[model samples]
Target: MSHPMHDVLGRWKAAFDGHRPGAMAELFTEDALFQGFGPAVVAGQDAVRAYYEAVPDDRRAEVTVLHTYTVGERVAGGFADVTFSDPTGWEAKVHMSLVLRRDDNGWRILQYHVSRVAAGG
Candidate 1:
């Protein structure tokens, strides 16, 4: 049987790959916290949606889960490698960490952080 968390991540990946910012934001909690490559942190669903929608349409991402573990009956954490690609063949890799919490609707991202991986590292 596949891990339930895998399904959650899969949905998240699909949303990103499909370029559906609303769908991506729906995977997060109302008050979720997000930090991308920048130092500024964005909070809440609307902000998250706006942040994702701002991503260039020419870019797409592939996410690979590196590790995951349950923090409690309702909380889990994981790490992933995210690769962003554009039509010009430009690519950038980022390391990501996520915290999820289960609610009546299922697991939703509570906290997400991503940082760019140094080139040639």
Candidate 2:
């Protein structure tokens, strides 16, 4: 079966690519958790909004999925490279796992954990 999670991920990519920070927040649930900014675990829709807003206006995120495999309900794992447009040109290849739940609004990410890939990983 095709995982609907792919669509959510695509929307997320499009949101960031177009510099629509607000759209990015829609991908998460009301109390979703994000680990995008270092060790800080940002929680809640409003907090996520604030986090996205803090990013430079011209900056954007690009995600290239390396792999994806679904587990039990609301769980999946994938590898991807995320690059941000910044002065230092920061880039990260991370192994990510997402926990999603199907609600009245369809699939939404509830928790996301990402770890930086090792050198040559």
Candidate 3:
């Protein structure tokens, strides 16, 4: 079955793989909080765009949706396991989670975070 979250993630994946930083930012809310692979967390769409812009153009992301949820009719969110790969075959795996809120513009990400998925403890 298809979910709204799937559609959002699908568009995100397309933008990411295409290295369209501006396009990716459009999916996020104006004040969205973001934490990519960078050290400090940033806020807002401009920061989000800058973060993606810094990523290598050849790097592509494959996301596996691990879970999803809805908070009433105005909010929804999900967790995903993502593998980012480059032309040289180098890859980085991480766990990502995002929350979205419905507004006049439709569902836009309110928060987006990424963290390293630890290896065997």
Q: After best superposition, candidate 1 residue 82: deviation in angstroms?
A: 1.1
Clashing pairs in 3: none
Worst 10 residues of 2 by lDDT: 77-86
Angstrom error of the Cα, residue 12, model 2: value is 0.5
Instruction: Indicate which candidate wins on lDDT.
Output: 3
Candidate 3 ranges beyond 4 A from true positions = none
RMSD of each: 1.2, 2.9, 1.3
lDDT (10s digit) by residue, model 1, range 47-102: 88998899887787888889988976899878999899999999989999999999
What is candidate 1's TM-score against the reference?
0.93
- Candidate 3 lDDT for residue 4: 57
Give the range where candidate 3 is weakest over 10 consecutive residues by summed lDDT.
Answer: 112-121
Indicate the residue-level lDDT of 109 in model 1.
92
Q: Using TM-score as the measure, which candidate wins?
A: 3
Candidate with the larger lDDT of 1 and 3: 3
Clashes of 3: 0
Of 1 and 2, the candidate ahead on lDDT is: 1
Query: If candidate 2 were superposed on the true structure by all CA atoms, what would the RMSD be?
Result: 2.9
